[model samples]
Target chain A: MEPDVLLSVRDLRIAFDGVEAVRGVSFDVRPREVLAVVGESGAGKSLTARALLGMVPAGATTGGTIRPDLSDRRGRRIALVPQDALSALSPVHPVGDQLAAAVRSVARVSRKEARARAVAALERVGIPDAARKARAYPHEYSGGMRQRAVIAMATVNEPDIVVADEPTTALDEEHRDQVLRVLGERREAVGAALVLVTHDMDVVREHADRMLVMYAGRLTELGPADEVLARPRAPYTAGLLASLPEHAPRRRRLPALPGTPPAPGALPPGCAFAPRCSLAADACHATEPEPQQVAGRLVACHRWADTPDLLQEAYRASS
Target chain B: MPLLDVRDLVVRYGTVTAVDRVSFSLEAGETLALNGPSGCGKSSTALAVLQLRRPDGGEVHFEGQELTSLTDRELRPLRPRMQPVFQDPYGSLNPRHRIRDAVAEPLRVQGRRPTPGEVAELLDRVGLDPSYGDRRPHELSGGQCQRAGIARALASGPRLLVLDEPVSALDPSVRAGVLNLLADLQDDLGLGYLFICHDRAVVRHFADRVVEMREGRVISGWRRP
Candidate 1:
């Protein structure tokens, strides 16, 4: 791994009961880079984030190397802001105490010391009246404020890498914009690697520096955010971008991919996405394609392995 | 004439003006989305449409009939024409009841009970396995529970369904499936939907007509965007 690479995940395979939920997914999150992971529900996007945090729940198992160059088993160097604030924060405890707990966990400071640090973290995330709001419980705060508290916990220790999983899922437009801006600012201010996992295509378009498209349980494409989205190299990536409602003005119809994802336990032969990909040929069902660089983009499709212009043509036609 | 019509609607919750002078009309088979931030009174207006909470002023008409003039006993039988799909699936479904019984409640409540064959058909129609009727609400995921809720709401064969952030709790990827299902149901049944949500992206995709609200008032008149 390069010295600048803050977190390098190689061949991450998360499985449960002999079924692979995330199969050999590999990517590098560079310092000061906001890497957005965009995919559908069963795409194993959240599982990849959970692997990095070392919090894969029961009945789910994770293997392969998640290189943590930032810290050892010492625990305070990584933090996450999950999608649902109600589930992430403590219901009974004051929001200040929860933020302080994060500080204590990472810094091993006194309760008094952690409380002071918590207020600073709140202020950094643009929380108004940081001191007063710190004492409020999670339920007392609105959806936007609860998200801010989550960001504070992630920043209290001042970690080098922060993971946010669908951070704006349940928030209003104003709140969603606030949370996205906070992540963008926090990543620049602290020089931390921000990995945002969401299915919201707009978030990836507006906030990410790089985009990684996952279909089923594998990474199908990765490159510069706008380049990958504008001219997606993989059919699955193209399908997802086409389905998004933002580009509806340019297209007459929102092109929806037919059928659902196969059960994770027994995937289709060859490319996992072959069943749904329109460009899939006979070879896609017989051989698993490896990630290859095509026209300055990383893609995992056999048909486009030789020519990226074909992907561009197909993407435009579909939209 | 419109299938559902509301004019100069106002609702009060003890000095709090929940909905102020809101006006709209929903034609049969057209989807209307009422979108706004929290406490903007979208839900209040929806509940008032069903007469769940009596409005302070204005008129609500369905198929040339005024709903405000109906009494409790008179309204009970008319409820089958409009149904609500609430936010939380787990909370909406009765935890103690089986799936079959829960869905059948709406049918039974209206003095019409479906046979076991019909109940099995309803479950399968909503994409659930017919065998799933015996399972309890706790046995299903949030998405599955919501499908059961949709089945229950559809049991009475309502012409209009009011959804309050129906898929908020589901994963975004799963959310698309539900949205598609709703769209498909509208086509097959020729039903209208009052879809209330705050996601502009969703409104852009699913809504036939978009109405934006702010500060307990109709900020914009109903129109197809």
Candidate 2:
């Protein structure tokens, strides 16, 4: 791992009842970088984020090393901005009290000092009247306000890395933008690297510096966000981009991925995506492709070079 | 004639006005998407048009018949002309009822006894296996439950379908499939759609025309560019 890498996950595997949900996933997050893990549901994006914090689900066995370089932290240097803020927060307590507890956990601070820090953190996330708002319970806050509070709580101690799982999935367009803005601003303020797990490609395109595409519990593509979006090296990545309705011309049917994601531990033999891939050939069916260095990125595909022009043309026509 | 029409619709709860002077019309085989943020009165507009909630003011017309003026007894006969599919299929569908009975209930409400084959065909039309009719809502996935909901909605042979974020609860891949199914249904049956959604990308693809709402008012309406 590079010296600047804040988090390095290697060969991570999660399984339930002998069924592998996240199989052999690996990635790195550099300091101050926003690494987006994009995939449709059941692709194990959420599980990978959980494994980063050692919070796997019940009945799941995990295998792999998630190395977070947080030597400076006295307690936990990693924080999580969960997808559902309401569930993550204490419903009965005022948000300020909950936030102060988070601060107290990381440092030897007094109750007064922690409360002040909590208000400041809320303000940092763009919540107005932070002191008064902090006194409000989770339900008193709007969806956007609750998410902001969650971001504030997660980053209150200035953690080195923040893992956000589908943070904007519940909000409307306006509120979603607000949450994303606050998340970006807070990350910049704390200089913390972010591991964003989301299925919304538009969010990844807009906020991510690096993109990691997971499919069937494995990494299919990892590269600079722009490069990956411009020309996906993996068929799964290409198919995901094509399926976006934003990429379709008005009145034109979207190019949809024909089938659902394979069930966990029930993936077909050989390439997991070969069954749905349009570029599948004889070689693709016989063996699972390993991640190989191609076009300055890591791509898992045997026939990646053959379909670049086709993807480019399709993207151009739609845009 | 337009399949559904609303003019100067207003809905208020207590001191707060939920929808303010929202107006739109849907022709047969057309889709009009109500796009906006949450708390923008999208649901209120739909409810007022359906007579599920009485509007504070406005006119709701269905094929030249005034729906706003109709009482529960008067509107009972016309209920089959407009049906709703809500966002959460699980919540919208009865948990204890078998899928077959759920689909057949709408037809039964309209004084028609549906055969087993008819219920099976309804399920099949929504892209579900006919055999799924025997199972309950919990036995199915979110997508499957949504398909069953759509199947039930169609059992009434409604000319207008009011879908309130119907595919929002499903995964992205499954969402696309359900969306495609909806489009296919509209095309084949010439059904008009009033699609309420927060997803702009979906609205762009699925709606023939789009109306943007904010602060309980229609801000803009135009043909898709």
Candidate 3:
């Protein structure tokens, strides 16, 4: 692991009831970097994020090492901003108490000091009237306000790493942008790495510094976000980008990938995505291709060089 | 005349007005998308148009007929012409029933036993295999279940489909496919659609006209030029 890297995950695997939800995956989160893990619903993106915080489901066995830079503390050095903020927060208590609780767990601060810090944290996350609103219960806040409070709670102590799993999924377009902006600001303010797990390609393109694309519990592509969006090396990644209606002509048919992802424990032999890949060759069906370094990006495909042109042509045709 | 015309529609719950004087028209074979944030009254306006919930005030005209003034019995005959495709296909479908039975429901409701060919054809039209008719909703993926919902809506031979966030619940990989399928169906069947959505990108791409709602009112509407 690099000296500057805050979190290094190596050969991470998670399984439930002998079903491998996250097959051996390895990645790193550098200090002050936003690494987005992007994929569909069954792609194990959320599972990977959960594993980093050691919050995987009960009975789900995990393997491999997660080395988070904890030179400053002993316990968990990471915090999580869950998808549904309303449900994640305690409904019975005022929002201020939850924030103070998170702060107290991380530090040995006095109660009054913790409460003042809670209000400051809420203010940092762009919540207006922080002190007064902090006194309101979770139910009293709007969805966006609740999400902001959750973000405040997560970043109260300025952990070394933050894992936000679909944090803006439940919000509307306006709130989605607001939450994302607030997350970016808080990450920069705290100088902490952020692992954003979401299915929205547009969000990844806009906010992520680097992106890792997953399919069937395996990483298919990993690279800088802008480069990956402009020139995807994996067929799945290209198909996902092209499938967005915003990328295609107004009335043209979207380039949708044909089949759904394979279910866990029921994955087919060879590459799991071969059935849906339009460019799949005989070699692709023979065995799963290992991640190969190509063009400064890690891509697990037999024909990475050929994908950019194929997808570029499709995108151009749409325009 | 337009296939469906809604004028100054208002829907209220107690002191709170969910939809305030929303007016729009859906021509035959046109898709009119209503875009807004959560709690913005777009869904309420759609429900009011369908008469699923009675409007406090305003007019809804279907084929020159005033829907707001109709009684339940009076509206029964017109029900076949309008159908709704809800957000969660899994929640909308019957868990224990087979796919064929679910798709055949409208036909049965109309006093006709669906034939094997009819069920297979309906499934095929939605891009599902005929063999899938034997399976239950739980056996299918989110995308497949959504297709079944569309097929069920089509079973009624509706001229207009009020799609409430139809593809939002599905994964992005399958969302485009469903949207394309909806577009194709509109072209082939000359169906009008009142698409209720929170996604601005989808409204821009899929709808012929775009209407934006916020704070229980229609803010502005425009054609997709």
Backbone clash count for every predicted candidate, in the order shown: 0, 0, 0
Per-residue alpha-carbon lDDT of candidate 2 for residues B125-177, written as tens digits (9 for 90 to 100): 99888999989999888888999999999998899999999988877767877
TM-score, ranked from best to worst: 3, 2, 1
- Flag clash pairs in model 3: none
Residue B98 CA error for candidate 2 (Å)?
4.1
Encode model 3's per-residue lDDT on A206-236: one tens digit a residue. Answer: 8999999999999999999999988888988
- Candidate 2 local lDDT, A1-319, one digit each (tens): 4368777889999999988898898788888788999887788999998777777888999888878634345225887889888898999999999989988887899999999999998998879999999999999998878888888888788877788998888777666776677667755776677889988878888989999998889899999998998888888888778667777766565566776778886788889999888899998889989899999999989989875554566667867
A114 Cα displacement, candidate 3 (Å): 1.2
Alpha carbon deviation, residue A212, candidate 3 (Å): 0.4
Error of 1 at A229 (Å): 1.3
Candidate 2 TM-score, true structure as reference: 0.93
lDDT of each: 0.81, 0.86, 0.88
**Ranking of candidates on lDDT, top first:** 3, 2, 1
Report the Cα lDDT for residue A160, model 2: 73
- Tell me how candidate 3 scores on lDDT: 0.88
Model 1 earns a TM-score of 0.84
Model 2, runs deviating above 4 Å? A69-76, A186-190, A282-286, A308-319, B96-98
lDDT of 1 by residue, A143-217 (tens): 777877887777678777788888877666776777677667766787777899987777888888898888778
